[model samples]
Target: MKQIILYAIFVIFFTWNPAFGFLSGPIAGRTGAPDDICGTKSCNDPPVCHGSYNINSGPASFFITAPSSYVLGETIDVTVSFSNTGSGLHGFQLTALDASNKRVGIFQSKDNTVQTEAYLNEYAAHTTVGTARTSWTVQWTAPLANVTYPVIFYAAGNQADGEGTPEDDYIYNTAAVIIQPTSTPTPAVTDGECDAETIQLSQNLLELQKGESREIVITVKEENDCVAGGVSIKATIKKGKKRISLFPESGTTDEIGQIAFTITAKKKTGKATVVFNADGIKSKLKVTITSK
Candidate 1:
């Protein structure tokens, strides 16, 4: 049966060689190569970029999942999925670019079929060792703290009937993600008052040169004369504007009911008063600032 043998050989060769027979799909960076080649008109004669070949519409979709807002200099998880309507083979190309179309952060993948291309895009397809799965994951790190603009991730997917041709294939389904910059919060400033029920000052007056600094200490006690450690105390320059400066103007008492603060004179010659208060108890310190 020579004729039968020839038919079997033909079938075997066509079945194995997708380029000649029933083998339709991507060959890693074949169809859509990302923003570089795909979107450019010079890559192909008619430019088969994403959305270029959509005549054979299907329910297949390509999408990416990521945070709506990203913190600068942070790593985040990004996932890309290409789900086909029917049981056809699917492939995808994904890339994250800034306003200048340059790659952002780093890309890492656990699947061997998926790989980085042109240092900017990632390409994934159904390999012989892997099945035509619909989902894949990738890791991306945000840009440095100096980056202020948003980043965009673009992706394109193709679903083919494994026929080794684009005749019945769905060209591309697109997806994108726009990552905005996270907002920064301002620090809150707080002021303090005294506690007369259980607090005393180590000094009632502070003498300092125009450019000198001195430490003022305070003592806290309970109603029964017990050391009130951890009592909150606040010091304020009630009578001085630019004459003096206080270091850590507010703090809590230590284990020995002692809280110390540093005061410095900012003027050549002036007089000022500092009031320390905690839980309604208050004390005063008269500061005399003079030239050296």
Candidate 2:
């Protein structure tokens, strides 16, 4: 009887009303591994976390339009959109990186380049596609144009990809643009850009009594290991220098967008702030641990 009850609870908890990108990847396979990552085993069907491909044969499409060239100090706008053509819901984030995959510019939020409208869609029964419509627009003073830049659309890599889940999934694309000054030099943007994408932080936070420790799966794209962009990621806790709590063994931009990390809350802790920053954006979340 106890085992039966426990199994029932597990079923209910493990199977939430999941209906989004997390469910849109490749076919079924118990492996849970994703394809196209740096180097890791691949799942049978790849448990969704589908990479630049789709499993449910979902209809997914995306595009971006921007000026081929701009003058220095001129505000540049980029528009991007995608449609999920299957029952599986979809979400995406965008990021502009230099040729080196190093994140570019300053956005308001430090989280993934999450979509503002909760990047979700619904797939009808017996249907292979759902649709999501959105455009990414941002203005920036032109940079050196001749230096080709890469615009990347970030879909959460396989949870094995790097860090964070679909809720925290950040999808972005990279492209190159040129800057031409109109006979006048523009001042450098030293204070950082004022653009920010608000991401719903991971929903798990716990309280640990003295000596009680909990390991958390921290998903952060900037902390990802396998992808090519080599995004310089740094972390801090309690406003001072702190050792990184969690990390992935290897790889980047897998089918699932996740970088697994562990965090342990020790004694003398009541409430603490775990702050993460990357690509000029910052996300600060609260973690509380009560004393016994």
Candidate 3:
């Protein structure tokens, strides 16, 4: 009877308790929490012992690395690294938001170690908890259009002592910010004549059969009618659903102020409009896809 009671106690303490640990990933909205209610409250609740969980304080054990500036509609890589060299398993969650607090970018995991949450599709977390991972890399695609500057990337990570419970574990939160590159004004020319900078496309309209592909060249010209090289360009689908697709959606012009993109017709047959932005100048291409 005594042995049975001891075994029962062990089961209740280790298995029956609800505050063991996430073991997978934390709940949604747990990154960069402004309060304890939605952040570490559940993890630090009863049934589990508490430990030091720091929020954007002390020697940062968790760090976020990303470009200081990003081009509109471009996909950038963001990495979250754990600097603590201690012996333990680690897990993390990362996300980005605009100044309005609205989720700004789409996050995609580069490997199986991380997974994008289905709740808002904005949160990326570890696939399995309690792993000896030092860092995670995720792709974040900027919004199709420019929003308020300074998109903030927030992340939260934990170092677990490989214990089955939350005790002796440490949680850390940190953030980083990125902004859009500012456009420089073109200098005025006092010459005989001046033409405003323009974005010219090889073809303004396209007709392609289903599963057909076509390439288009974009050229940028300055006010002096000279080819302006090294110009940033971004393309976005303005109309139609997913009937058409474009490759190299965003890039910089070559030495000849030219960039090429391939457009392909998908299964659906319909009309689609692709808007292109060269620096601040804008242009559009109309595409019609028909049955083969």
Which runs of model 2 end up more than 4 angstroms from their true locations? 1-45, 51-58, 83-88, 108-132, 139-292
Per-residue alpha-carbon lDDT of candidate 1 for residues 1-292, written as tens digits (9 for 90 to 100): 0000000000111113344332322333232222344342333222122222331245676567788667766767777676646744665555565534455766665566555543343433333332266666766777775432235565545555565433454544333434345543212222322223555543454555567565555667555444566678988989985899888879987654566677877866778988888877887878766553
Worst 10 residues of 2 by lDDT: 1-10
Ranking by lDDT: 3, 1, 2
CA lDDT scores, all candidates in order: 0.51, 0.30, 0.62
> At residue 28, what lDDT does model 3 achieve?
65
User: What's the distance in Å from true for residue 108, model 1?
Assistant: 0.4
Predicted candidate 2 versus true structure: per-residue lDDT over 1-292, tens digit per residue:
0000000000000111254323322212111111112112322132333333221122344444566444543556555444443222333223343323333343222123332223121100001121122333433444444322222212211211223232222222212222223433322222222112221123223333344333322233322122212223344575312322323323232122222233454656466665555455555645554443
Q: What's model 2's TM-score?
A: 0.30
TM-score of every candidate relative to the true structure = 0.45, 0.30, 0.51
Ranking by TM-score: 3, 1, 2
Give the lDDT of residue 128 in candidate 3. 63
**How displaced is residue 45 in candidate 1, in Å?**
6.5
lDDT of 3 by residue, 1-292 (tens): 0000000000001211246535566666666432212432344343443333323222336778999767777788999888845745677777776534557889987888777855366888776632557788888888866454336676777666665665555666566657443332333433333322788665566655577666666767675555566677999989874889888889987654667777877999889998989767899888877663
